[model samples]
Target: MNIDKPHAGNKFFLSEISFLGYVVTRGGLRPDLQKVDAVRDAPTPTSLTHVRAFLGFASYYRRFIKGFAAIARPLTNLLRKDQPLTCDGECERTFSTLKEALASAPILVRPDHGKPFILITEWQSEAISAILAQQGKDGREHVVEYASRTIPDERKNDSAPQGECYAVVWGIQHFHPYLYGQKFLLVTDHEPLLALKKLTNYTGMIGRWAVRLQEYDFDIVDRKAEKHGNADGLTRLHRPGKVPKGEEITSWKEPKQSEGLEYGQVAILPRT
Candidate 1:
């Protein structure tokens, strides 16, 4: 094949480009050295305001910091209402750890829309978290993005299964800009979600969630809880809603078939 192009100021091929504090290269996206150095050289915070400032700056690169929420918990806790402003030893260590993590942050590759994405999600009483990643040509998963947030106090007491179910919906919606018209794989440690379509008596909330999920194209898979350490740590600080023992899901049954609609199938597989 032969290709020809007129010399143009805005159409020349280049090895890489810096955009939004990230360096986009042929291999992947990496944090800009200048930005990384700025965070690395930031002074220790003595006030809550300072702490928040630091966090706001560092957060832009949180995708490079695995277990980011867990690592920054000590610092974030100080921001709660009526909490003391003291920067304890733990907070100091967290600051240093965050700086170090940013300095050595991984380069996340731009996802190939043609490839299937793997979404990992976790749920705790106060938080829902997820990681968007994809398997590389080298057969290793590469990070694409990470998202997490605290649930409101009012809804914090939702049942464990419901919370898990919400994690699925929230994660997919969070990444809707990328997932809206694509097929991907959803991975979760919560078995209940994988079996959601099989539940004979689904809750109102679950029913609503299932309906919303129908718009997307994807597959759900169940993995062992122990293997989901990436998204797990983001929600570790929150207490988990408990499920009593012996509560077997005897109502498991296939979801009803809808005319003109095909539900995404759940695929159960052994751990690699």
Candidate 2:
């Protein structure tokens, strides 16, 4: 039998048979292949609307980008109230940079429940706050998420120490629902560490804020200024103007734990 030519009278049926045989023989039968849906083209975003759309998407994933809000400040300013602006060279540059940053931004990994989560909280001011979460394993740490916010003007100058305290309290409280039933560490350099339990006497808004912090299960560890260098770097990264290079300030002092062992002791052990 000549394989290239139809076998006989039933040409159409022979062609169908040949095609089916070729498909089955060349690509082994796969149930998943049968369920494969036809590929559909994604609609292209309009250039006029792409900026806004991409920025919104970037904002949604901002926690994955260090200094995101700070980096995008120039671009965000364009959307502010009564601001006369044009998407000129500077705007276009910022827009393009942001788009590129968004495209290359890393996906945030979920925190490991079996591991202790480290939160480095920074109060750039009473209202402007930031937190960097890192997971430790086999004696190393990697960032898991970055969170930062600027308090409304009404909240600034309220009491730097108390505000920082409240920020941590509220931050943990806000993130508690997701992190409930898990062990975590809080990092801060504020002197409030000596007076955290006395928050109720703080007075004014700070006093009210302190009441909410009493419910969380956490221990406040004082990060000496020298130890908190990396965390401080993260705070400076959120400051106005260009961000500097090098490792953001981070601290690794052992947190006091129950059972007469420090949290860092267990985490620093080599993984088998």
Candidate 3:
């Protein structure tokens, strides 16, 4: 795009670099300490405008914080159109926690397709969350990425089974780019959801969701709820406010008749 000169941000022959607020290195993406310091030393938000400004900035690094939606819920509530601007004890606490979370955020490593992946998904009435991890050379699992979001308002009252099914579906969709053809372990805390693997001709909300799974390869595993406490405590993470570049959030039921896929071929769902 430049006829004579390149952008000032361009650099070559560097061992590491900071790009779009994150530090890029062979190990993976880490938060820039300078940016983290700003968040850590930020003063209390005394006005509605201040609150919004802070969230807008923090959301840029939302990928670093696991349960961002839950932690920011109280603060976001204040953003309601006609709500009064008040920072209660909970809001004050949440704001502090956010600052601390950024300061202590872990370095999220880059995804290596060569290694096997383990995806853990759990859902509650208020939210649905998932964590994608890989076994590092250290023989310990390290998180690759985190994704979570509050369920749509109208579906908040869905039964436990329905919510759990929704979680699995959304989790897969959110990480589709990395998971499309790869065989990975799909972990779920809801025992009822494990049954989807054997379901045949099932026709309902859950059935339609199962049909989407035809696009990927995975084996479902069960985990206990108590084991998922960290994710549950905030009720959990992702790029948070914005979709990652190159991701296409598509409707569930529509299959692209054109554009043949490279990995697994899509199969038409039979009528129930």
| Top candidate when judged by lDDT against the true structure | 3
Q: Arrange candidates, best TM-score first.
A: 3, 1, 2
Q: What is the lDDT of candidate 1?
A: 0.72
Worst 10 residues of 2 by lDDT: 33-42
Q: Sort every candidate by lDDT, greatest first.
A: 3, 1, 2
Error of 2 at 109 (Å): 3.4
How far is 32's C-alpha from truth in model 1 (Å)? 1.2
Candidate 2 Cα outliers beyond 4 Å, as residue runs: 1-51, 84-107, 125-129, 132-134, 200-202, 224-272
How does each model score on lDDT? 0.72, 0.50, 0.74
C-alpha RMSD for every candidate: 18.2, 21.3, 16.1
Q: What is the RMSD of candidate 2?
A: 21.3
Clashing pairs in 3: none
Collision count of model 3: 0
User: TM-score: which is higher, 2 or 3?
Assistant: 3
lDDT of 3 at 107: 85
Highest TM-score against the true fold, candidate: 3
So what's the TM-score on candidate 2?
0.55
Q: Model 3, 32: alpha-carbon shift in Å?
A: 0.6
